[model samples]
Target: MVTDTRLYRKVTAQAWDRLDSRPARRTAWLGYDGSLPVIAGTVICLVVQKLPGGGGNKPVEAS
Candidate 1:
């Protein structure tokens, strides 16, 4: 799908604003340092866990 550059930028800016305005306080005690990697890893894990054969077997990669 194609996205318009101007609209994308506007939406991104608004999202950032809302994200920054969120009420939750960031903490370092939970192994999270308010980084994107933590969020990405959480989403990936959730998706993998929901997929069939996710825990049973993994696809072998070719070297």
Candidate 2:
């Protein structure tokens, strides 16, 4: 059995070269701003939580 050392080294080098080549993505919190959309969502959730039934308002059906 003949082992190709040159090919093995080339493949190893290629793999290492791609280790940090991915485009870095900024985290959600880091890229997000204090905008109206965020504020609106928060307010909506708060309002929902403040509802009479504490959230779900489905009427119970009598059997």
Question: Residue by residue across 1-63, what tens digits does model 2's lDDT show?
Answer: 222343232111111121222224435447655542311111111111123334553433321
Off by over 4 Å in 1: 1-47, 53-55
Model 1 lowest lDDT segment of ten: 40-49
lDDT of 1: 0.29
Q: What C-alpha lDDT does candidate 2 achieve relative to the native structure?
A: 0.28
**How close to the true structure is residue 3 of candidate 2, measured as C-alpha lDDT?**
25
Mark the regions of model 2 whose C-alpha exceeds 4 Å error after superposition: 1-53
Every model's Cα RMSD, please? 14.4, 26.0
* Candidate 1 structure quality by residue, lDDT tens digits, 4-23: 34322211111112122232
Candidate 2's TM-score reads 0.14
Q: What lDDT score goes with residue 3 in model 1?
A: 27
Give lDDT: candidate 1, residue 53.
37
The C-alpha TM-scores of every prediction are 0.14, 0.14
